[model samples]
Target: SASETPGKAAVGEENIVKLQHVQDTREFFIEVLEYLPGGNLYQYLEQKEMLDEYTACRVSLRILKALDHLHARRLLHRDVRLQQFILAEPGDPESCKLADLWCLASLPRKKNFMVEEGRPCDLLTAAPEVVKQGEFSAKSDVWAAGCVIFELLHGHPPFGGTGKALVQRICCGEPEFSELGTATGGLSDNAIDLLRWMLQREPGQRPSVHECLKHAWFEGYNVEKPSKQVWQVEKLIRHVKLWGKPPHSRRNLPASNLLASKRGIVTPGFCTYMGATSVDIDFEPCQMCQGVLEVIGKSEEQQSLGSRVWYWVTKCVLSLWGREENPKQIQLKVCVKPGSPWVELGSCTLDDSTALEASIKIDKPIRYVRISLRGNLGGHFGIAVRKVAFYGYQVRQIPIALHLENLKFLRGSRLHTHAQDIHPKEVNARVHKSLQSSLRVGRRIEGTGAKYRVYEDICSGSPHITTAAETPRLKFPQGVVLIGAVLGLRYVSEVPSKESAPPRLRIQIVKEVNAGGDHERRMKKTLLFATEDLTPPSWKANEVLGNGYVDYPVMFSTGIRANGDDRLHLEILFQNFSGTAHVPADLGLSFFYVPELQSPSTSEDEGLWAGCIQSVQSATVESVSLGMRKLLSIWFPFHFPRSFPCDFLLLRFYILQPYILVSLT
Candidate 1:
């Protein structure tokens, strides 16, 4: 090729040219290539001030096409910014080619890669979910491309601020051409529509690169009308409804939080009205936090734990928006029912300067939690909470039928006033405090016909499973002996919060049955058996606790039942060795039943397993708070495919927290 070119010419496997090392034989060398004299998009934009609308459109359209090509090859150009846009040919803006593959990533990457594949830690024109959870895919590239297009049309980036303001603006605000004086700026409605679709806060809602190319904005004269304008309008209405609304404070998930039909539409941001209300002032934009409960007020108005039993609120989170006029002092309390010698569990105070927090933790389960606020020198107004979340379990849900019941309370875990009796009535008069609830938190909660999801088994370290002796002929990955079908169960906390997370603890898995005769029936039936110690013993004393949540995995023997009773009475009993931790009331567990493999049949070649989902039926989910942890188990009759290998099931894990418990500290 060119004799003066700086970059090397490949020589196949022996493709070594004299790599130009930095001066004086330093180890690092640079790959020199023929200099691109045309200059990049940033330089062009600086010289021209702003690109013409058609030229801008053409550039964006070309970039999208190039991106589509990369994405089709399962690659992601994550940093699709101005610097990367190079002239495909000198002096031709229409032929711009994207450059600077700093953050380029291969598609469908691992979820926890953190800083691999050019995923920048800084928020440099990325999607909301990317900023929120380091999640990226082809759609994420589309978002950055949209941002570049926006910057081209206007003279600057759409949401230009520093620090938290920049993140919030990018995540929550809708930039409009109307804001840029659309009449004179002259961006077509189709163009605006395409940009808006690409920049949607929710990644699931955004269009694919192919879909973007098909949008009316790119069609020139063949602009296509959107198929469902009503759907778009409804989405906009939902967004509007979520904002600027008065806080019902202390209200359950009200009508506004849910879509009317049973469709599986999960909207973005916090619509669920959980937590306490701040002062009731009429404001233009809803002071509502995006994904948490609002808990700001002058006087005491704690959340009630419902009219039923005791729930251990393991964690509580308080996300600050900003204080109103009077927010100098903050007092938080967790106490039992009101009486003399008031049974107080814990109390903490927050000053204005050092008050910012993502979560606040408590050791015990208490019915009442009271928050009070006072203002500082300059102003006097109520405390204004942006978001508040909690985690805990009800006392009655523990099912301490006989041996597990505690007649005497531990001194430190004594949020309960009944120091001697476990019955609520004996101490109900003294323990009538406030907690979240015993009712369903979300409508799509189990027993509502929502499809169950298969979650990966979660355990600290590399804990292995041991099955009871039954089908000793069968085996599984990780030395798991086949008993019946091992139920892959994962716990879900409703109001999952960092502070709300209980300390490290063990959970006992047991199956109960009606063993006693009809009239003379006893309480519990031991239909389930464990092959070894209940909790995995390999957990180290100095185990690294997560930012908040931990997964306690349990495996049960599923072989004994012969009556075709698909449902098993699986009971989760939390071990109280660590008094500092309490199971959140919002505890949820899901199970996917996998049948045990049978020994080969009449034919020698007949196998024990298959690849299909035919053997496994519907997965079951039980919410601890709603008391349906046992009876409402799901068991669809789907079976594993008739013929396939049994050992191919690869276990994977997923973390899905409820809407109300997002941490913003």
Candidate 2:
């Protein structure tokens, strides 16, 4: 009755699972099947609790189709249960298919049933005959399908408990029908009647799988109701049908409640559908947009001011679409909140090649952005948008002073005087002022005691990192450059509890040019290090940079540094990147500073300095040779001379041969 493959089913039917390959390793056989992203019906039921009568009927119809596929031929899915039905699409109930065919058994040639010695299925969904005796047939699977249907309509299985008590219940007891109508939704009389016929304890008394498929419930027969209520029910079913269709074919499907984007980040602002125009919201816009909002208008009336699409996005928003014939005029508007007057963000006429890129300067907190279409030209088939995106940007500040920290230079009382000389109070105040001016706060981080919103994990009474501590300043000498830096950092915590937020260190190297004049002064920053909560080997007892110190070396080959005209500023900031709250970290310059290449007084300083010089020299040599190789490769006609070593050897012979002859004569 079915198209046969060697050891697999026809699989032409969508309800049956496709067996891709069979591998025999003598000991065991491995059947590689199709990959299904959606887990199983059991897991789906656990998530959804119970399906509504309408949704349950749809699911039961598919289960019967899968059973009929196996039953048409003499095959029986002996272990039919909720776990066997795998969904082709995740979260879609109608995408279920019969996947587990390992326990498939054939009916006896002369008889309708076969006797099995072992129990392959659980006692809960097992048929009465299968539990009492070892006999199994197509009727046993049908009985299991009935249990699944009951569980779908109700939240739990008909039979409960385990072991001997469960066996006695299934063998002799009847399932309780209380809470059937009130569990998921009001169960239709047709649904109740179908359940009663399917769960007829005796195998012969139950309807066959084909007869169950022809039931009045699946045939869309419901009891007579008021005309208005009946129309509403039909409308609801129609809406579900439209949503179930493919994306391109779906049209005018009602507005959906905003769900989290595929990235799991729910973009700010509630999305509302307005006007009579047709629009589609793409929930999974991978890299293009957080939420891809598309609006389409069929007629000129739909393009009027009354037909506007309003959406909420934060930061810099880029909205673009494929050019329709005769460019459409689009007006963009923005407001801080709903009911607030909208500020016009400029209107533009767009062509096929032009794109709309608008940067909304978030002076206050912007909550909504509205886009309205207006145009009177040829080819009025509506506008189609290909992509829309919203993102934020950060701006760093300019430093006024130059600083270089050498812990070897700052020893004992010298450290105290240097700290006092910098005016810590003024520096801290300036740092705080500059940070507040640049950093923008979101709506969530604006209210009283709202600093914790940014640092949600950090608790009250934790160490506050409100200061951006500065090191002593030193001017660069004429023609001298900054080679690199070595830092000694140690973690210091009074509270040794894991509940506290981990410390983050941000070390900024700022260079200020022409510090004498306010007009000519320009600052450049180099972020030397930004650590992400790194744990030290051991915690230190105090704020001193002595014990439990770890050394960090930062080197640059093609060095970009400050000259004599510029002053270097080293600012060490300790704060959580997720929040502005600061923790304590001891930072000190580990190695001695060498302004020029000179012999070291101690072997320890010499080894570290020598290593730095060696690295810089090696980098310079490699860069010079690489440049020469590239020049030779391009200069040669048709790239004839490929090898640089052979060319060098030839050049050496010409110069040395003439000198050797003159010496010999």
RMSD of each: 25.6, 29.7
The worst-scoring run of ten residues by lDDT in candidate 1 lies at: 230-239
Q: What's the true lDDT of residue 39 in model 2?
A: 87
- Model 1 / residue 660 / CA error / Å: 85
Q: List candidate 1 segments past 4 Å from native.
A: 1-34, 88-91, 108-124, 181-184, 221-665
Cα miss at 339, model 1 (Å)?
79
Per-model TM-score versus the true fold: 0.30, 0.34
Local accuracy of candidate 2 as per-residue lDDT tens digits, 1-665: 11123226535568867878766675766667798889899899877656666667888998998888778877787888888889889998778988766577667688889888576677778999998887798888888899889988766777765777778878888774543432212466788788878888998998989999999998773222222110001000000111211223114322231221221111222222232223333221111111111113222321221122111112333343333322256455643222224456555665443443323332211224454444413334434342233322110001111111121111111101001122222433432221122122223323443321010010112223322544444333333344333332333333245565655667676776675777888777777667666453454323212232232222111123344345655665555422322233223221112232111100111121111111101111211222122221111111222111011110000001001000000
Among all candidates shown, the one with the greatest lDDT: 2
Top TM-score prediction, candidate number: 2
Task: List the candidate 2 regions with Cα displacement exceeding 4 Å.
Answer: 1-7, 24-26, 181-185, 221-665
- Give the whole-model CA lDDT for all candidates, comma-separated: 0.37, 0.44
